[model samples]
Target chain A: MLKPEILDPQGQAVQRALPRLGFEGVSDVRQGKRFELEVDGPVDDAALARIHDLAESFLANTVIEDFTVKVEEMVGEEK
Target chain B: MLKPEILDPQGQAVQRALPRLGFEGVSDVRQGKRFELEVDGPVDDAALARIHDLAESFLANTVIEDFTVKVEEMVGEEK
Candidate 1:
């Protein structure tokens, strides 16, 4: 399980501007996490399906954000 | 590229105790990051080899710490 750093530049901008917007004392609002998973597979169609589930069930905060999965064929193999 | 939250629990514990050691204003010493990559492959021997490279060259801060990789056969896929 991996959670990425919560440094939202957009959030920070909003946080800084909030006092002007009549809000204060709202400190330490950080960003969410990002997780990368390396699953062992030829990464066929079914494997892709599971990667989706892994993110939905355990990896991401669906309500707050979304994620993407990239399938890279490890860089030193043939076919 | 996923950079995990820098929350060093051990660091936090040490930070809290620092005042006793005459340390002051030493704030914002955070932890490093964690990245999990899902490479597309049957994750054969060669694939594992590349995953190691991905982490060392791009994913991790080799000078500061180390990371561990787990190869989960994407759940729901057959061998």
Candidate 2:
């Protein structure tokens, strides 16, 4: 998630612009990014730890954003 | 959220690059955007429906991506 201050401008812009498009009652609109990871094997502790590191170093800009990493198991499905 | 095929390339790149950094067990990584909206008043049906439309027309690229809009109530806090 984007830091509140960092995200405020975009939110404010959305809030201001939407009413013209017939959308009212919308105040704050903060935007950020999400990453969904599919693991090759069981997402054990070791894998989670690596993912956490990757999230901190690669996926998220920790300086101005906060991110959550979740591991979803593909149960009998191909993607 | 980005359509699976649209997000696949970035996911594959991350998967390939991370292992070289000594991180394994990660197969797929799909990335997309998140928007957090703070409304001015009670978020009723009317507000939600407007948000849905805003999401469709402005926030997401409907032709190639999917998006979800959620309203978060700010309780006893100033932002």
Candidate 3:
């Protein structure tokens, strides 16, 4: 996500339009991206660290954005 | 998030590129969006319901995407 101090024009536009669409009471809005990754092996601490590194290096642009990575779920055959 | 059955070309491109970038073990990738909205007053169940309705009607297209809404944090004077 973009840093808290950075300007978020996209979020600002959404916030302004929300009340116009009759969904009132929202004073502020922020937007971010979510990525879901399926790993071939178990998600250990080291694996989590690697994902964090990947997020910092490849997924998110460190100059303008900050990111957090976590395990969402472990998929079985359904995945 | 895009429905499971939907084809995600963007995520597919990322999954294919990750290996080239030396980030291994990720077999698949799916991408979605995150929106954080700040309510003017308290975030009770009624407010949450309103947000969900907004998400369904305005934020996400129910035919292709699904959305989930929850409170992340409550702001004080810093907000």
Task: Indicate which candidate wins on TM-score.
Answer: 3
Question: Which stretches in model 1 have alpha-carbon errors above 4 Å?
Answer: A1-79, B1-32
Model 2, residue A1: C-alpha shift (Å): 1.9
Q: In model 1 chain B, where is the ten-residue run with the lowest total lDDT?
A: B28-37
| iRMSD (1 decimal) for each model | 18.2, 1.5, 0.9
DockQ of 2: 0.74
lDDT against true structure, model 1: 0.51
Residue B15 lDDT in candidate 3: 96
**What is the C-alpha lDDT profile of model 3 across A1-79, one tens digit per residue?**
8888999999999999998999989988989898899998888999999999888887889999978887777545556
lDDT of 1 by residue, A1-79 (tens): 2223544664456456545654444452333343434344466787677667655754456655556666656446567
Clashing residue pairs in candidate 2 are A1-A66
Q: What lDDT does candidate 2 reach at residue A76?
A: 70
lDDT digits (tens) for residues B1-79 of candidate 1: 2123444565455456544555444342233343334344456787677667655764457665566666755446565
Each model's backbone clash number: 13, 1, 0
Chain A TM-scores for all candidates read 0.51, 0.75, 0.89
Per-residue CA lDDT of model 2 for A1-79, tens digit only, reads 8876574676677778888888777666777788888877767898788789889999899999977776555557866
lDDT of 2 by residue, B1-79 (tens): 6776564677678778888887777767777777877777767898788778888998888888977666554556665
